[model samples]
Target chain A: QKEVEQDPGPLSVPEGAIVSLNCTYSNSAFQYFMWYRQYSRKGPELLMYTYSSGNKEDGRFTAQVDKSSKYISLFIRDSQPSDSATYLCAMSRGDSNYQLIWGAGTKLIIKP
Target chain B: DTAVSQTPKYLVTQMGNDKSIKCEQNLGHDTMYWYKQDSKKFLKIMFSYNNKELIINETVPNRFSPKSPDKAHLNLHINSLELGDSAVYFCASSWGQGGADTQYFGPGTRLTVL
Candidate 1:
């Protein structure tokens, strides 16, 4: 099994709808969780970041992490057509190497 | 002012040819990284440098080599590239090597190996 698993979803949602993207990992040592948004033909950009098991909110975006279940989620409230992109989840153990294990991004389309 | 930038935005090269991708960050960051995103959008770290020193090196083939001339520059050179080397390469920089440090990524270099 991959260290981090995420559904490569072309999840289509109507504008103004709420969108939830999730990722599951088998590693228990992950302490830092992050969500990145990538547009077509562009590099990934950091969206939300959270440490350990808790929720962090930034405007319309909320990031939640549950260490016990090895699960992480990113929720988008009142999504817009401009939010259409690939959402990628990444985690790290906070070790010296500080290498991030990334999930296969989920493609989200917020239709107008 | 771009925080992170890469040269040769699009590169198309024949198999067995050598090429290089250059990365520079004006953010004065202490850490830089090289990542490869395959056609499936699976991003993987290939190498990392901290203070111009090699810190994280993944199990990439020897054909790939990363050089750090200074804290602001990290370059990747591939020798005798293969067809499998076609992918999007990204350069990222952060203030430090900590896991929580926010990384700024470049626009990425799309390489096509024929």
Candidate 2:
């Protein structure tokens, strides 16, 4: 099994709807969970990250991690058309620091 | 200023050819990484450098090589590029160390090997 597993979703949602993107990992050693947003022709940019199992919120985005279940999620509330992009989930065993394991990414489309 | 920058934003060349993609970070970061995103949108780590020293080298082909001349720069050189090498290559840097350190990524180099 892949270290990180994320559904490569082209999930379409209407503007203002809540969007939830999720990832599951087989490695319990992953301590850092990150969500990245990537637009067309652009590189993935880190949106938010959390080192613990609780949820971290920033404006319209929230990142949740369940270390016991090895699951992570990114929630976008009041989603806008500008939220249309690929969302990538990444994790690292803090020990290596830069050795990040990234998922296949989920493509989200927020329609007007 | 752009935190991370990569040269030749778009690279297109024939198979078996040689090419290089350069990356530079103005964030004064000590760690840098090279990641490849394929057409399927799967991002995989190729190599990483910490202060101009090799740190993480993934299970990539030998034709691909990474060089870090300094802490602020990491260049990816493909000796004999194959069609499979066509993908979007991204350069990223972190402030200090560990995944907790937010990584800033470059705009990405889209390489198309025909």
Candidate 3:
């Protein structure tokens, strides 16, 4: 089984909608969780990151991790057209920062 | 300055051809990695190097080798590439092996094997 699993979503939402993207993992050892945004033809850009299980807020994005359930989420408050891209959830265990288990990205399309 | 960069934004080659993708990071990071993104967009780690030392090899085929001349550069060379080898490849680098260390990625190279 893949360590990380995410729905490959073409999640479409109207402007200003609250968008929630999620991922689940089987490894209980994962302590670092991250969310990355990848636009067309570009690399994955780190959007929100958190250590262990907690909440970290930055601008309109909030990253929540539940270590107990091995689940992570990325929430967008004011979704915009520019926010339309692929969202990928990545996590790593202990000191293996060089190895990140990535999920199949979820494509989000925000309507104008 | 670009933190991470890759050459040949797009490559089209025939099957059985050998090609190498070059990567460089100016972030002063000691660790570098190579990841493959398939058509389904599943990003998988192929190899990693720290200080020019091979640290992690994810059972990638011997035909696929990663060369690191230094901490700042990591290159992937695939020999006799197959049609399945056509995918987007990404290079990334980070400072340390910490839970909080942020990894920066380079613009991916889209490889098309005919």
RMSD of each: 0.9, 1.2, 1.3
A1-112 per-residue lDDT for model 2 (tens digits): 8999999989999999999999999998888889999999998888998986999999999999999898999999999999999999998888754477889999999999
> Candidate 2 has which clashing residue pairs, if any?
A97-B98
TM-score of each: 0.97, 0.96, 0.96
Point out where model 2 deviates above 4 Å: none
lDDT of 3 by residue, B10-103 (tens): 9999999999999999989988888999988888888888899888889788989999998899999999999988999999998875434677
Chain B TM, every candidate: 0.98, 0.97, 0.96
For each candidate in the order shown, give its overall lDDT on alpha carbons.
0.94, 0.91, 0.90
Q: In terms of TM-score, which candidate is strongest?
A: 1
TM-score preference between candidates 1 and 3, better one: 1
DockQ of each: 0.77, 0.71, 0.63
Model 2, TM vs. native: 0.96
Per-residue lDDT tens digits for candidate 1, residues A1-112, read 9999999988999999999999999999899999999999998999998988999999999999989999999999999999999999999888876788899999999999
DockQ for candidate 2, please give it.
0.71
What candidate 1 gets wrong by more than 4 Å, as runs, is none
lDDT of 2 by residue, B1-114 (tens): 988999999999999999999999998999999999899999888888889988888899999999998999999999988999999999999875666677899999999999
On lDDT, the candidate that comes out on top is 1
Better of 1 and 2 by lDDT: 1
